[model samples]
Target: MSTNAYRGALLGIVAALLLANPAYVGLVMDEPRERSPTGYTATAITPTNASDQRTVVNRVGEEEVLTVAQLEDANEYSPYGPRYRAPERAAESLRAAVESGTARTTGEGVTFTLRRVGANYRYLRTHADDSDAARYHRFDVVRTNGSTVVTTTRVNRSTVAQYLVYKDARLYTALPEYQRETVDEVIAADEYGYRPYNDEFHEVTESVVVKNGTYYVFTTGVHVDDFGPSTKTVVSLLLAALGTLALVTSIGFTLRATRERRDG
Candidate 1:
């Protein structure tokens, strides 16, 4: 009935609500500036008619969202195309990959959209000791393909030559120099294994642009380094632990105060 009691009750309710949903407290940190320019760029890849595979000419702001297939056709039968995959990487890491100076890009005009290029190991298992047994390659993709590449790492550490059981070869790719370094490191990871790593990463790309009537979006996410939505999960958990501690401390102090007032 007292004003103090009412105030305590109100504080308790407010704290409960905040602890329940982090978004309510604006606990979800958004990094619009940190997002990749190329992420979520393809806004209109919907097939215009269900009867045909044809896509509609939908505009996402100033840019037109065309599928990789459509762009390839416009240029030629270029093997390089767009793809959509899970998880996103940081621009810094992307830059590092390119800086390693191993990536090479090769494709005639249209098919030349290999955002990533790397090697595959067919006989990697037999030659586990040899990181240079897999054949190096790079992919060139073009419009509307909706391509997504996932790079993973394993603690066990193996090479493409080991996983695919390919004959003697080394890790390599064709892209901007640094980009190739990224591919080489990932393909050389121990955890990336039989399954793709892209499925588990969080996306943080800010914007995507197709300049000169065509563009390429390249990205790679590394474990314990760059995380996506899953990273949010980790944050949420840590906050919850703090919330629990707060609740306990608040209750303990409240009870102590009550006892001292009664004794006085």
Candidate 2:
């Protein structure tokens, strides 16, 4: 009818189109879905009859990343640290093998085990490379000059004892005679659905919890979220109410404008 009425109608149509657009609807009307519950709360840890002094040697996974310095510092020295083959011991072993008629005649491809494999420091004297020193304990059995084979160093000593080992964002603690419990269900419920499985990453705390003098360790980065089922439902209802109000107000405006035009 009038220019003002036509302009108002055009704006209403544009607004309605924008609100009903499929892309807009898809973006804003995403069906609320469940999110992975991760992380842990302090309350999740409790006391139990399970002994705290539990010893777990292979608790660390193979995928865990460790620097050379970290590995070496884990104990007295790195497990993969440098090792040395003593020249005197090597010669003696070869001599003994020859006396026993086990030595090769050509002095090539001779292989024998020497009990006196020197420490990492001995290898450091000859090798200038820092990497070579880092791998002093682990030796490679290699073939050299066609027939000669090089063997790794060896020792008759038992494995070292370590109570704590932390690498690659993971910490393992082995204590004796302590008792503790892990309440995952309680934690999940209380913390609003964050549940961490065994050995999974948890970001809630840097220090492991010790329950009643017992020790517990959490692995990986854990996160806690405020959004859950109740939150989703409230948001959805609020959006629906706003949308209904917008629609009703637009219809009222149109009707009132048309009535005014007819009266005029």
> Residues 44-71, candidate 1, lDDT per residue (tens digit)?
1112222111111111111212122232
TM-score on alpha carbons, each prediction: 0.23, 0.29
Clash tally for model 1: 67
Tens digits of per-residue lDDT for model 2, 151-230: 33421111100122222222223222111223334233443433444332333234344444534444423555555446
Q: Which candidate's TM-score is highest?
A: 2
Model 1 weakest 10-residue run by lDDT = 53-62
Model 2: CA > 4 A from native: 1-55, 61-215, 219-240, 260-264
Model 2 vs. true fold: TM = 0.29
**Overall lDDT per candidate, in order of appearance:** 0.31, 0.36
